[model samples]
Target: MLKVYNTLSKKLEEFKPLEDNLVKIYVCGPTVYDYTHIGHARTYISFDVIVRYLKYKGYNVKYVVNITDIDDKIIRRARELGISPQELARKFEKEFFEDMEALGLLKADYYPRVTDHIEDIIKVVEKLIEKGYAYVVNGNVYYDVTKFPDYGKLSGQTLDQIKAGARIEPDLNKKHPADFALWKKAKEGEPYWNSPWGPGRPGWHIECTVMSMKYLGEQIDIHGGGTDLIFPHHENEIAQSEAYSGKKPFVKYWLHTGYLMIKGEKMSKSLGNIIPVKDFLSKYEPDVLRLLVLSAHYRSPINFTWEKAEQAKSSLERIKRTIERLRRIMTYEKLHIENLSLDEKEVYERVCELRRKFEEAMDEDFNTPKALAEIFEFISYINRKINENKVPGPLARYVHDVLMELLNVFGLLQKFEITGVSAEVKPFIELLVKIRDKARKRKDWETADYIRDELRKLGVILEDTPKGTIWRLSK
Candidate 1:
């Protein structure tokens, strides 16, 4: 049985979806106010692997991630850039997906934008007001946390503790300091939508609750984000959502990715240690970054340095080299089943055990660090068997499939494959693809088109889709 570390209960619980064999997941996406950084990748890639593992286990997963298109951050950033919030959000939203694509992440089922769901948000805010859980003063609506007796249950804080650390919002008209805004009245020149209480936009917390409800119903199987969101943001979401829907639990499993740190500090712009996702991708392969994130347990802080990235890169190359070795061996060394030696038989049995142990490690709270260790162990053993020429051709093929299957489950080695190109030249092909993408982005059509035509001659086909650009060797 699959298990997860639920932030809600603070326990490792067996995962059981609300509906049989169907998993509904809602991960809080980026704010889109600026370039998506590696910190964002830490959360996105963590959940991507989790969801992929669910699918690998035969569960039909519906994953939804929301884009905070309009918010205080977007507005402030836009003002500084002398552009409209919508324009700034649009630009970064495109760039954000580009970075995600470059990382080869599994696309979310529904990337609902908050700007697109203002009407739905307004309806929920209005209902909260009618239910006596929220109040409006001076055209700003605030959720009265005192009315919800179960407030802060997700963050494991009591009302007293909540008040003790209450955030100071601009609206002092709220009855309690723990109370949070449901809707913020429009500023003089900011974007606004028609609401029951004049013109305003939904607050940060309410948008996730409303969007998740609109897409996946009230009680979802998994609601996840970074651990930083466990407080105020997710805590406020729980309070306001349950208050509006009269639901006991707004989410079934609350999962949060551990913070991504750099130089013993969290990667934040204020600290001048932010590494943009694009910058990281340009420096390393997509799987290298995924390897770094999965090298540690999802709930453990990932302290990144150049040494860590280099370590992940080395490990990834080892994995790919092993897979390539198996592939190369498959074309020869045709030993019959009956002709197999005792050691060859043991290798086959070891391969089977590798799958079982991988599943076991993944089952226990999605323990990726252990799961990865299992993969590496298998790789090391199989490589030894290959060196001895003891692996049968069919066994070699089986090992290749098993390695690809397991690595793909971790969202690694899923992008470019070695078909027409040799293993040594694959990195060069990937580099060309990246360069062409950049050229296209810069509107250097002459260079972009030149690369595309040259690559076409070299049997590389670039397929552009809504998710992002992907390349393949033409069969």
Candidate 2:
């Protein structure tokens, strides 16, 4: 059975979906004010691995990530850009999907937008008001924290504590300092929808509660997001949901991934170090980014750096070379008739052990870095055996199959294509090397160094091996 570290219970608990063999999950999506950054990528990719593993283990998983198309941020940004709210949301939604697809994140089963479900949001708000859990003040409706005794259970913050930490512009109509808005009265020159209390828009928290309930029912199997969302966002979700449905638990499992930091600091716009996913991917391959993210445990913070990405790229290239060499050896007719050697048998056993270790690590709250290390260990063994020329045809094929299976589980190795040097570029490189060799023979050190420097700028790396000069693309 798979185990998950639930933030609510503060322990690793065995995963038990409300319905057997079927898992229903709801993930909070982007607010669509700007382009998604690397932090967003980390959270979504972590959840993608979880979903992929669940299907690999024979569970039918239904994943839903809501699109928050309406909010104060959206309105503020729209006003700044001098566009309609719908236009602003549409532009960013397209950009968000493009970035997600580029990173190989699977499309969620349902991507409900708040604008499309305004009727349902209104209905839920109306129910809360009728049940004495919500009150309207001066055309704005707010959820009364004083009415719900269980308000602090999810966030572990009492009303008194929230009051102490609260520092927003005071409004006279509010009953308490900690209460949050259910509906905000639309200001002049803003998008407004007709409601019982006048023209207004749904609050940020109510959109998710309504959309999740509309698609996945009142109670879900798992509710997941970043750890930063565990505050009033998720806490309010639980309150409004349970208050409306009279359900004991709104969610069975609460999973939160840790933050992504850069150089020992949180990545944020205020710090001026926020890197967009598109800009980052333009400089590095997607698989390299994936490996870098998975190198750290999902629950731990990932520190971002270009050097870390380079290491991941090198590791991935080594695995690619091993697979290619194994395929080439298996195609050799002379190797087909030979019996497997003792070393080949040892490699096969090591492969099995590595697979077991990978599963064990993942079964323990999705420890991806440990599982990734196990894969690297297996790759090292295969590389050593190939260098010694001790691998047989059948054994080589087995290793290739296992490598592909494990890599696919992490969405790596899906685009394993042998990159050949282009005919034109190959000839140019050969010509330059020949000239460089002539220059070296004549002891023209300046000319030789210039040639090497130019090629390096063109993404070509040259190495001096005993066999002669070897060149490859700079990963």
Candidate 3:
């Protein structure tokens, strides 16, 4: 049975979806006010791997990631750029998708934006008002924290503790300091929609509660975001969602990814060290980033550095070479009944052993760092077989297929054209790419261009980034 760490319960629990063989997941998405940094990439990539593994285990998954297209950040940035909030949001939203694709992330089933669901949001606020869970002041609506007796269940704090530690904010005419907004009355020069309260927009926490209900239903199997969101964001979400629906548990599992630290400090705008996703891609392969993230447990904070990225790049190259070596060994027909002799029995058993280890690691709270070590162990076994010349055609083919399936579960090796390649051509392609790199480094423009044009004629595409030149078979 698979098990996962539940942030809400603060324990490792066997994963049993609300409905048999189906999982409903909701993750908080970007605000879309600026470019996505690597810190954001870590959260998305962590959840992407979890979703992929759930599907691999024969569960039908419906994942929803919300896009906060309307917010104070969006409004402020839009005004600074002399553009409307809608235009600014749409621009960054497009960029967010592009970065996700470049990182090889599987797209969520629904990317519902807050701007498109205005009617649904207003209706929820109206329902909360009618239910006595919310009150209005000066056309602004706020949820009555006192009404929800279990207000701080998710964050594990009492109302008194929250009120004492909460940030100082402008007096919003709320009943208590812990009370949060559900609807905000419109201010001058900001966008507004018609509502029963007045012309205004949905509050930050209300949009998620509204969208998740409309798309994924009242309660979900999993709800995830960064660890920083646990306090006010997720705590408030749980309180308001359950209160509105009269549901005992708003989410069965509350998951949070740990922070991505830079130089041992948390990434922030004031730090001036936020590295954009696009900038990281320009320096290393997408798989390098994925492997680096998976090298640590999802709930553990990861320190980002250029040296670590270089190590990942080198590690990925070694894996690619191992794959090529397997393919090269398969070119000559060698597997026969006699070839699967007594000596090969242990080899076959080792394959089965590694599969079990991989699954066991993943089952234990999606333990990717342990899972990766299992993969590396299998690779080492294959390398030993290669040196011993005991790898037959049947064994080679089986190993190739299994490795591909395993790598893809982690969203690695998918971007590489690993299948349907002959042993003779791949080596020459690598050689030519290396030659072109040397030529460019020495400012040999003619040689580099000639090689690129020649490769293009043969359906090989070459892209030159600051790191180096990379080639792929043209689609």
Candidate 4:
């Protein structure tokens, strides 16, 4: 069984979806006020792996990540850009999809935007108000925290604790300082929608509650986002959703990913240290970025730096070299001439052990770094056997199959397109290999060595066998 770290219980609980073999997940999506950064990439990529692994294990996953198009941040940004909020949200949503695609994140089952669900949001607000869980004052509607006995259960804060810690603002209409807004009155230059009380926009928390329930149902299997959103955001979502639905639990599992820090500081745009996903992906391959993010546990804070990225690139190249070398051995017909040996059995056992270790790590709260280490262990074993000339055909095929399966679970090795290498170069390398074979046959060591050195300079390596010479791309 897959075990997940549920933030609700603060424990690693075995994942049991509400429906058998089906997982309904709702991830709080980007606010769309600005470009997505590496911090955003880290969260989405981490969740993407979760979804991928669930599907890999034969669980049907319906992943829905909402787009918060109508919000205070979007309104403020639209005003700054001198454009309509819809136009602003549309532009940024396009950019967000492009970045996500580049990062190899699978498209979520539903991309429910808040603007499109205003009716549903209003319906929830109306229900809460009718049930005495919400009240309207001065054309603004707010959820009455006191009415909900379990208001702060998600955040582990009681009403008194929140009231004591909350910064008191000049809102005479609110019954208590701990109460949060469900709808904000429209200002002169702000975006507004028609509501029962007046023209206003849905509050941040209510939007998620309405949209998630509208799309996924009353209670979802998993609700996830950055750890920073646990307090006010997720806490409010739980309050409003359970109050409206009368459900004991609004979400079955709450998963939060840790933030990305740079040089011991949190990565934020206001700090001017934010790295956009597109900007980072331009210099490094998407798989390299995945490697870097997966190098750390999802629940642990990852420190971003150029050195870490470089190491990830190097690590990916090492895996690629092993893959290429294994491909060469798998396709060599003469290698099948000998009986599969005991070393081959050992290699198979090692591959199976690595697979088991990888699964164990992932099951332990998605410990991606430890799982990645296991993958590298398999790579090392395959390369050692290849170098030792003991890689039988069956063993080589087994390695390839196991590696692909593990990489698929992590969403790596999916982009196996031979990049930066021309198709014409392959024929040229093959011709050179044939010529080198002829020279070796004639005992022309000097000429063969010259050809080999030239090919090496051209980023090609030739392994000479008794039958012939095989060429592969050199790292």
Q: Provide the lowest-lDDT 10-residue window in model 2.
A: 331-340
* Colliding residue pairs in candidate 1: none
Runs in model 1 deviating more than 4 A are: 331-339, 419-475
Pairs in clash, predicted candidate 3: none
Candidate closer to the true structure by lDDT (higher is better), 1 or 2? 1
Candidate 3, residue 349: how far the Cα is off, in Å: 1.5
Clashes in model 4: which pairs? none
lDDT of 2 at 146: 89
lDDT of 2 by residue, 117-236 (tens): 989999999999999999999899999988888888877878888887754346678998768898989899888899999998998999999999999999999999988889889988
Instruction: TM-score for candidate 3, please give it.
Output: 0.88
Misplaced by over 4 Å in model 3 are 168-172, 331-339, 418-475
* Per-residue lDDT of 188 in model 4: 95
Better of 1 and 3 by lDDT: 3
Per-residue lDDT tens digits of candidate 4, residues 1-475? 5799888888889988999999999999999988999998999999999999889779999999999998878888898999998899999999999999988889899999988988888899999999999999898999998898887777787777787784435378889887889999999988889988999998899999988898899999999999989988999899898989998689999999998999998898889999999899889989988999899888899989999999999999888877877765675344342465687667767877998898888888788888998888778767767777777665676678789888888788787855556776667778888888889889999999999999899878787755456667764
Residue 392 local lDDT, model 1: 67
Candidate 4 displacement at residue 61 in angstroms:
0.4
Q: Write the residue-wise lDDT of candidate 1 on 1-475 in tens digits.
A: 8888889888988888899998999999989988989988999999999999999999999999999999989999999999999999999999999999888888999999998999999989889989999999999999998898888788888877766764654446978887888899889999999888999888899999999999999888899999999988988888878888888678899999988998789998778899998888889988889999999999999999989999999998788767766775674455466766799889888988999999999999989999999999988888777767777688798778888999999988886456667778978977988898899889999998999889999887776645445566553
How high is each candidate's TM-score? Answer: 0.87, 0.87, 0.88, 0.92
lDDT winner: 3
